[model samples]
Target: MTQSPLHILEHTFGYREFRGPQAAIIDALVTGKDALVLMPTGGGKSLCYQIPALARPGVGVVVSPLIALMQDQVDALRALGVRAGFLNSSLSPEAVRDTERALWAGELDLLYVAPERLIQDRTLELLHQCDIALFAIDEAHCVAQWGHDFRADYLRLNVLHQAFPQVPRIALTATADVRTRQEIIERLALEQAEQFIAGFDRPNIQYRITQKNNPRRQLLQFLREEHSANAGIVYCLSRRKVEDTAAWLCEQGFNALPYHAGLSPQLRQHNQSRFLRDEGIVMVATIAFGMGIDKPDVRFVAHLDLPKSIEAYYQETGRAGRDGEPATALLLYGLEDVVKLRQMLGQSEGSEEHKRQEQQRLNAMLGLCEITSCRRQTLLRYFGDNLAEPCGNCDACLHPAETWDATEAVQMALSCVYRTGQRFGANHVIDVLRGSEAEKVLQFNHHKVSTYGIGKNLSAGEWRSVFRQLMARGYLDVDPEGYGSLRLNPSCRALLRGETAVHLRKDAKLAAPEAPRRSPARDIDPVDLPLWNALRACRKRLAETQGVPPYVIFHDATLREMVARRPVTEAQLLEVTGVGDSKLARFGEEFLAVLRAEDYEGAI
Candidate 1:
């Protein structure tokens, strides 16, 4: 008799139960059905297909986007005693031939291949010859043309359904808004596939966004205060910024590295390998760095510049705290960031409709930044997920923002813009409003206007914040044709006429929290610290010896559990969440030795 999926999951993967829709997805695929799964990062999406691959008769072909991702997945699967291999450029010719031979002989349960390779005629013919159980398309959002991670290779994936109509197919993505979701379904021809939309909230991550003021200094402060000893990723918008920030962080005595497409392939791979293998390394990178990374203990993701869209922001920040431990997502934005981003969008090559859509998306991102309510609620609502109440984890909830009636301030700002002829940008308009005697204010003779000096009580930063909120709330618009000149929208007429009241978060008091002196790992007991360190040391040593990522050896969560529970025997160890039979046989003795030593020490 054949073993059940639950048996394979418990014995091979070491989990006693399935998470979210894993069991349902696996059962559907195993029984020959298609699915489109939208799960958050660290949500156990891999198991949705992996279990089906093991239970089904033939090979489960995974369409992966990156070579590193394929290699990591194969390594983890092999560690679980699963028959898995990959066919990608990273593999040597002999190894490719061997993998191909194994697939033909029905010896492999799962075969991971890049989309570019999978779409090839030669590869298609070979796969057609094999009895395929299913085609699992990882990162399916890449097929969306408007998506941040779009790939032309993904456009060819429709061939999978065309050629193997009888085989089940499962497409999975961690981030996709409603539009992108529809695009994935239409593009991949998955109209008949069951759609499983999981909750988008990653509750473990605490979200915070501060207005950018001396971004480098602010980033350093955030690092020194909150995440000095933890692994994190700092994202910059440009390659130059990435390099400079990484170098600067290194000078500050952090293990920092730069990763961008401009770097040589060898250097990129080296930096990525270092980030994956080492603990407490900060990878300062452009958007090119993340996507397929499987590192689990990244404690935070900091954004030094504004992201292009909420989708981009979500996907990038989602890289952190994949182990379900508490993590931080910090973003710093300023008016200049909005101007630069809008300018870039204006100059970018695209159809008029595309540009309009991009602008709308940017506007949505700006709204998220300026929201006075719970950040998590605002974020989830963008993806069509509603939180019943405030998340109480985000900065807005932890330290609620104070809103003030900005009707008068907004009226003054808009009047100033109008009186200044709406031909000048924010700085000039702000100068006129705040009664500045700067040359431009005098050059334009703006100091002579009645609205001039009306905003003298508000500081430049406060005025800037008010203006940003006005633009975000649609009472004001940035005139791209006029070099970012502030223009009053028709809606401002109501406020300017006292017909409407505007409220805004008081920007002056919205300072970031001071760094706490205590460690984030305070949940661990004092008595368990030594044992925790011992477990980590043993795991790190094993990772070094095996030459795989440490998380692949065992997640930090698993180590913490071992320290807390102090399992004494093999049977007790198997009760741990991540302890599968394969890991128990391979690493059980080493961990047990450390635990037993700690136990003996305590007894003595």
Candidate 2:
């Protein structure tokens, strides 16, 4: 008799139950049906396919885009006593031959390959000779040409369905919007597959977006106040910024590293390895990083510039707090970021239609940043999910923004731009409005205009906010050809005529100074601290010996459970989550000794 999926789940993976449609999706795959799974990060999407792969007769072939992470994944599976191996560019020819022999001998349960390798004729022939369980395509969003993470190799993945129509295929991604979802379905030829759309919300993450005022200082404040001893990722818009930020953070005594395309491959790999293996290291990077990073305990993800679209922002921020522990997603944006982003988009070479579509996406992202309502709800709604109520965890919910009518201010700003010939950028128009007697203002003769000095009531920052909101709301437009000069859009006509009343959120004067909120995951009792630290030290030592990430040894959650339960015997240890049979037989006695020693000490 074959072991049931539930039996495998308990004895192999050691989880008590499946989470959020995992069981249904697993059942569908185990029974030889195609599936398109849309699950969030840390949502156990891997389990949906892994368990089915085990239950089925043949090895599961996983197509992954991340070459760097393949070894990590295979190492983790090997630790679980699963016969998993990867074939990629990183392997030697002898190692590849050995893996092929294992596959032919049916000695492997799962195999991971890159899309480029999987599409090779020889590789396809080898797969044809095996009794394949299924094909799992991770990061399916890369198939969409317009997606931020597009990979040309992914476009050829449709051949999987064409070549092996009988074998089940599952396409999984955590960051697909509605259009991208449709594109995935059409491109992958999974039109008939069962679609499992999980909720997009990551309730464990607390979202915060602040106007970028002294952005470096704001980032420092966040790190010191909230994530002093935690692992995090800081995303910048440029490679130079990433290098500079990483260097500055290191000077400030942070375990910081930079990752980008421009870095030498050796340096990039070394930095990524250090970040994965060590604790409390912060990786400052451009969008080039964090596609397939499996680190589960990242405490925060901060953005130093505006992302290109809501999908891009969501995907980047979703990297935080994957362990279901409380985490922070901080974004700092200023008028300059908007102007730079707009300029970039304008200069990008694409069809007019494509450019228009990208601009619309940018506008949507700007709306999300400027929205005064619930950030989470607004974010989910963009992905076609509607929350019944506002999430109480985001900054907007914690500190509701206060709005004030900006009718007269909007009129004055628009009139100033118009009267100044609409060829000047926001800085010049702002200077003219604020009655600046600067040389440029006099050279442009804007001080003599009737609109000059009409807006002295607002500060430079306040006027900048008004202009940003106006652009975000479509009341103003940027003339890319005119060097980012401000122009009045048709929407401004209504505001100019007093036919519409515009209200804007009062930008917070400064980021509030507050300690990081305590999280349940980190709420170990005073007495348990010593034991927790000891357990962590033991895990770290073992991880070093094994050359695998500590989380691969055991997650922090599992460690916390061991501390809380203080299991004395093998049976009790087995009762703890994540302590599978292989781990029990391997390191059970070592952990039991730690617990027993701690218990004895407490008695003393």
Per-candidate TM-scores read 0.95, 0.97
lDDT of 1 by residue, 143-232 (tens): 999778999999989998899899999999999998999999999999999999999999989899878778888888888877888889
Q: Over 4 Å off in model 1, which ranges?
A: 508-521, 598-604
- Judge candidate 2 at residue 195 and give its lDDT: 97
- Give every collision pair in model 1: none
Report how far off residue 515 is in candidate 1 (Å): 9.6
How many backbone clashes can be found in candidate 1? 0
